[model samples]
Target: MSDTQFLAGPALRRLRRREGLTQAAMAARIGVSPSYLNLIERNQRPLTARLVVSLAEQFDFDPRSLRQDEAVGGVEGLRRRLSDERFADLGIDRDEIAEWLAAAPQAALAFARLYDAAGQGQAATPAAIDPMDLARREIERWRNHFADLDIAAEELAEELRLSNPDITAALTDRLRQKHQISVRILPVDVMPDALRRLDLHARQLQLSEMLDPASRAFNIAVQLALLEQRDAIAGIANGAQFSAGQQGGQGAQRAAWRLFRRHLAGYFAAAVLMPYGRFMRACEATGYDFTILQRRFNVGFEQLAHRLTTLQRVGQRGLPFFMARIDRAGQFSKRYAGASGTLMLETEATCPLWVAHAAFDHAGRICTQVVSLEETPGSPQRWFTIARTVEGSGGNGGGAADAARFVVVLGVEAGQGAALAAARGVDLSASGAVAIGMGCARCPQADCRQRSLPPRGKTLVFDERARGLTPFEFQR
Candidate 1:
C-alpha cells in the first residue's frame, strides 16, 4: 500500500482539516514547506518517505493509513464528465488526474461555476447549512427522555436531598454487595472480554467487555453516580418543562416525549456527578474554568459542557448558556443548549476563534479561548472552549482507521460581560447578547465574514450597486 498510488489529495486535506490544521500548520509539524505539502495534496508531487514518517511520529498517524485513498464525493462525478475529451490524446495517468482533481480546489470551483451556469447540475453547492437543525434534532433526543422521567426526577430530588451523600456511597456499596462487582482496568486486547453482567447464583456482578479504557472508566463512574445522587439527579431533571397542553400532533407529541426522557436521564447523570449547589459553588470558585471542571468532575469535555446548560435549575440558576460539541474536522455529533429554536446546526462548521479545534493542532494540548460570535445578540458572550486529540477504540494496524477524535466547547451568555471583563469587575451586557447564527439560514446577522448562505426567514432584495456584506440584500 505504501508503494501504491493510493494517496488522494482530498483524503489528506480532510484528515488535516479534521485535525483543525491548515496546510501551513501541517507542513510545520512535518518539517516541509507549505508549498511542497500543497503539491503533494494536489498530486503534482508524491509524498516522500520522510514526510510520511513524520506524520506517524508526530501525530501517531499511520503511514499505511495515509496511503489509502478516500473517495471525494461530488467532485469525482464532475471530473468524469470531461474525462473522455480532456485527456484522450495525452493518455493521462489516472493518479495524475486524481491529484489534479483533489489539489486544485480553485480550478475545480471555477469549473463547477461554469458547469452550473451551463446547467450541468454540479453536485456540491456553495450555500452553507444551518446548524440549528442538527441542534434541534439532538435536543429532541433529550427532550423525549425527560418527558417520561421529569416528575419522577423532581420528586426524587427533594426527598433525596436529606440523604444524598450517604445514599450515594451506600448505593455504590449496594452494587458491589449485590453483585460482588468491582471496577478493574484491563489491557486493550482483553477489553471486549470485559462484560457488565450479573452472576445471580454466585452473586457476582462483573464488567467483562473489550471497551475503550477511557469509556469503560467513564461508564463505571456514571454507574457509581446513579447510586450516589439519584435524588439530586431527579430534581434537576424535572425542574424545567417547555409547555404542557397535550395538544400537539401525534408525531410532535411523541418527539417531545422522547426528548424529555433523554434529557431526564442526562440530567440525572450530571446531578450525580456535580450536584446543583456544589456545581454552582465550583463555578464561582473556579470562575468557570472548563479544564478545572473537567478535572474536578472526572468527565469528558462534552459532558461538562452539556452540564453547564442545566445550571439553570430554578432558583439556583447560574446563567443562560449555550453549548456546542464538534469533532476535529468541525463535524458536530452532539449539540444541546438553550436557544436551540434559534440557532442552526446545518453544517459541521467551527469558529476560527474556537480553541477546541486548535487542541487537535497538537495532540494532548489543551487549548482554551474566549471569542465572540459575530452575529449573536448584545455584547459578544464569552465562550470557554477546549480541544485535544484522543485515540478511538479499535485499530486496523496503526490502531483503527475509523478512530475519531472530536473537539468540545461550552459557553455562557454574558449575564455580566465577556468572561474576562466580567471577572475583572467590568460590566458586560447580559440580556441583549446572544449567540449569533452560524450561517445565513439560521442567522440574522447583516454582514458576517462567515456568511456562506442567506438567512432563512428574510426577504432578499437585489441591488448590485449598493450591496451590503451579504451576497444578497435581505429584509428582517
Candidate 2:
C-alpha cells in the first residue's frame, strides 16, 4: 500500500451497510476492535494497510474503496465553488469543507449544483443548464469509468482478436462480415464536411482519406460501438439524473443526453482498442511509458493518455491520473479526473506558469514538470505533469493546421510520480517544483512574474514608487 493516508469514513460505512454488518461484527471479521473501526469510519483515524487488505480479503471489496470517494463529487469541486466572492464572508476552511464532503457527499454535490445555478443567475432547469457542463458533471460523477462498457469492450476485443498488428483491417472486416457495412476511405474532396460519415442507404461506413492509421481504427471502433453497444450506452445515459424541473426546451435536454451518449461510445471505442486487462498489465510493466504504450497500442498521444485514466478496474487498478487538453490561448477543451484529486481542471483558464503552456514552444516533444499548488495554507498539493502537443485531425492546411494544435497534459500526484518512467531522475521535491494555482483569477501567488490576474477577493495595490515583479499586485 502507498504511504498516503486513506481517510475514507463514508466509504467504509457504506461497505459495512452493504454487507449488513455492524461495526463490532465488521471489526471482529477484520481482526480490529469495534472502537478502532468506529474511528476509521468517522475519519478520526486512517485505515492501515493491514486493515485494508483484511477487509478486501474478508468482504471481497476493492481496497481502493477505502480511499476518499472522488466519483460522486470531490472536495476540490466544492472548494472551488466556495472560493467564489459570494462565499468569501463564510470564511470556511478546506479542512472543514473536506469533513463536510466526507460526511455527506450528496448534500455537497447538491450545494455545488446550487452554487453553479446561482453563478448562472438562474435555477438549474433542464433547459437552462449547459449541455457541456451536464456532460462533464456526468463524466465526473462516474470518475470516467463505466464498468459495463469496459467489460463489454474487453469481451469484444477478445472476440475480434485485437492483439493483431492490423487493427484497422480487423475492424473493417468485422464491419463487413457482421454488420454488412462496407468500409470505404473517401478523399477529402469527396467528403469535405466530416471525417467519418455513414451512408445508411448504401450500407457503407465512409472515412476520410486524411485520417491516420490510429484515427482510422478509432473511427471504425466508434461505428462498431454505435452498432453493438447502443443498449449499454443508452442504459447508462438514461440512468443519469439530469435536471427536469421547469423543462420546456426538451431539445437541449436531448442534445445533452446525446452528447453524453456519444462520449460513452467514444470511451467504449478506446476500451475496445486498448483492452483493460492487457493495458493495465502493460502500464505496470512499462511504468507507463507513453511512447512505448503509444507505439505498442498503435494509438495517438491523446488517445493513449485518455485510455490511461480509465484503468480503475476492481482488484486490477492502475495509477489514478488526471488529464486536460488546452489550446494555445489556455482554453480547456477537455478535462478528466480519474481519482487524481488535483484542482487544476476547476477553471477554464489555468496557471500561466504550468508546463502545459510551455508545451507549445516545443511541439511534438514531451515536457515534464513537478508543480506545487497551495490550495490550503501551509499544505501544498504536489503533482507531476506531462505535456505534449498533438496535431488535430483537420488535415494540414497552413495556419489553420497550426490553429488545430492542442496540448494534452497528464498529471499524477507527486508521490506516484516516481513510478512513472517519464518522471524518472526529475526533481519531485517542493523546492524544485514550479508553483502554480488553479488559475490566475483564483491564484494567490503575488510574486509570480507570469501572473496575469490578481487573486479573487483581494484589494489591488498599485504601487508606483516600488513596482513588484508582477504587474498586478494585491494586498495579501
How high is each candidate's TM-score? Answer: 0.46, 0.81
Model 2 TM-score (2 dp): 0.81
**On a 0 to 100 scale, what is the lDDT of residue 339 in model 2?**
72
Off by over 4 Å in 1: 1-172, 178-218, 221-263, 339-359, 362-402, 415-437, 440-476
- lDDT for 153 in candidate 1 is 40
lDDT of every predicted structure (CA atoms): 0.50, 0.82
Residue-level lDDT for 237 in candidate 2: 96
**Worst-scoring 10-residue span by lDDT in model 1:** 122-131
After superposition, candidate 2 runs with Cα above 4 Å error: 1-80, 83-94, 102-110, 119-128, 162-165, 244-251, 396-403
Tens-place lDDT per residue, model 1, 76-187, is 3233323322222344444454556656644654564444333223222222112233224334324223322333444444454555444344334545764466544444
lDDT of 1 at 378: 35
Residue pairs clashing in model 2 are none
